[model samples]
Target: MKNDTVGRLKMGYLPLAFVFLFFATELSSQVNIADPFVLRVDGKFYLYGTDDKKPNDGIPVLVSDDMVNWSGPAGNAAGKLALAKGSSYGTRGFWAPFVVQNNHMFYMYYTANEKIAVATSDSPLGPFMQQEFRPLNDSLKEIDPHVFIDDDGRKYIYFVRLINGNRTFAAELADDMRSLKPGTVVECINQSQPWEIISGNKWPVTEAPAILKHQGKYYLFYTANDFRSPAYNVGYAVSASPLGPFVKYKENPLIRQTDKIKGTGGCEFVTGPGEKLYMFYHAHADEQSPTPRRTLFSNAIFVPGKAAGESIFQVSENKVFLKSSAR
Candidate 1:
């Protein structure tokens, strides 16, 4: 009878142990990756963004097997490439680069001196070669280039143009992804909105525009206020078309710094395995001295029923404990 009881107890404990092990694996899979840009190409994932250090002069790249733990700065595979001859702009350090692969060729869109440029590479970890120095509206001082390929085999580049005294504008790229198509500039939003407009500030500012298409509508996400100021925050606007007539979300400034946390801005969104949405950005370290030395943080973005749903860009509770896990 005692042997029978022991057998039953062992079976119960076996299932319990399995459950614990499964959760442990799932928890281990959740890693803290900063400035989180996730790109999946040919069955592999690549992440690119700014490192925690300020005035970061180099582009940092990370690769992951399962979109969890990342492997590197990809071992010196990226840097500035010479601008093509006769291209008169964008000859400087690379910053805030976003990479995409199409037709087995890799393209990197990056910002320098508030101008956006394009480079191409045969490999994802690239010694990318510069193809053009100025790829957007030559008249506009633009930055934070985000490229999207729509379902109709059409390509578009979405970026923020600081114009008309420091307001943000959005424009579309030509199909070739090399330059802005004529008459494609659409003034999506300006600092005129009561929430965007600030008192005693001569410059109305908005920048870092990222676009995602969801359920027949396009969502435009951006940041506003002076990045160096305490008021830095993230906001969103929506449109039925890629180039819009964007409607600012009633709840503008979706995420901002509170008394507890300081210096919150620079937003990018990525969808990971299991269709999970993640927001990647940099913030000031709460415990570290001299807050300018910010660190990267990631948190799950919750959206429901539509692609333009609300987002919360806060550091995950577990992320606070995650030491810099980069290898």
Candidate 2:
């Protein structure tokens, strides 16, 4: 009788131990992607970012149903890629992917081999590839391509040009969506503010440009400082037009590092349940050592200036931590 009781006790404990181990793995597993951008289509969210673990895979994508629990692409346990390497223009260095839908096709604007390029796919979970394997323009080395289409249907591409230490620039994209329009290139924002300077030096580094149009004004959201710096943060500039004579907000560094997290930047906005705005970004995995392999984070944005008829965006210090468990 005592042996029977012991066997039953051991079986009950086995299930309990398995449950605990599963949740612990879920809570501790990091996404391991940098420069995350979330795109919501038909109530399902697809995440694309710089693939730190498999750079040769081109762009890696993760999927989520409720924005809290994320899984590998296509319900796979692991190893799924949206843009495969050698299938596109870039041989390596694919970073900062931004996607947009036009005419029933999805276009992915991203950095490859330190140059801005665009690839297209029928679906957002894309094997996005280029018609001809080439960078957008070969005149200069650029990264971080953000394509914005205005209300009147004019398209503009905002990117980081390596002219004077990673300065941000904007130009009209040609109708083909593969090249820039002639004579439309304009410098959007330069790193002149003190917070934008890196390591007490006047190093101009403003990249990861995201444009949000609200109340008929263009708000350009960008990251400042070297991305590896603990001081790397997010700020915004307001302009009347897409190609902007943009004015930096008086209160800059909108999304900054906290006591626990460092290298907090790479801001991308998306609307969640009931139209609540959320900003997705990444931070250094280790506080002491900043590297390319960062962890993803998101937070709710409170925009009081929008109620006042202005272009202002604010993210709370409290973040929404995403788990890598079953959705």
How do the residues 1-327 of candidate 2 rate in per-residue lDDT, one tens digit apiece?
010111111111112332344355564556767888888889998888887766656887778876656787542212457888877788888899988888888888888889888889888888788778888887789998887777777888889999768889999988887888999999988888888887655557998988777656787889989987888888889888889899999889887567768888777766655445567888887867766555554444434464465635566555554556434
Clashes of 1: 0
Highest lDDT: which candidate? 2
Give the C-alpha miss distance for residue 63 in model 2, angstroms. 0.7
Overall lDDT per candidate, in order of appearance: 0.55, 0.74
> How many pairs in model 2 have backbone atoms within 3 A of each other, for residues 3 or more apart or on separate chains, i.e. clashes?
0
Give a tens-digit lDDT track for model 1, residues 1-327.
Answer: 010111111111112332344345554422322334556665677766544452234455667665444566563342332222223335443456677777777777776666777877677676665543454445657777777776675666766666655455656666565677777766776664566656677877877676666555677777777655556667777777877888887766765455655546666655544444445565555534324334333444434433445332222332221222435
Where does candidate 1 clash, by residue pair?
Answer: none
Question: Which stretch of 10 consecutive residues in model 1 shows the poorest summed lDDT?
Answer: 1-10
RMSD of each: 11.0, 12.0
Maximum-TM-score candidate: 2
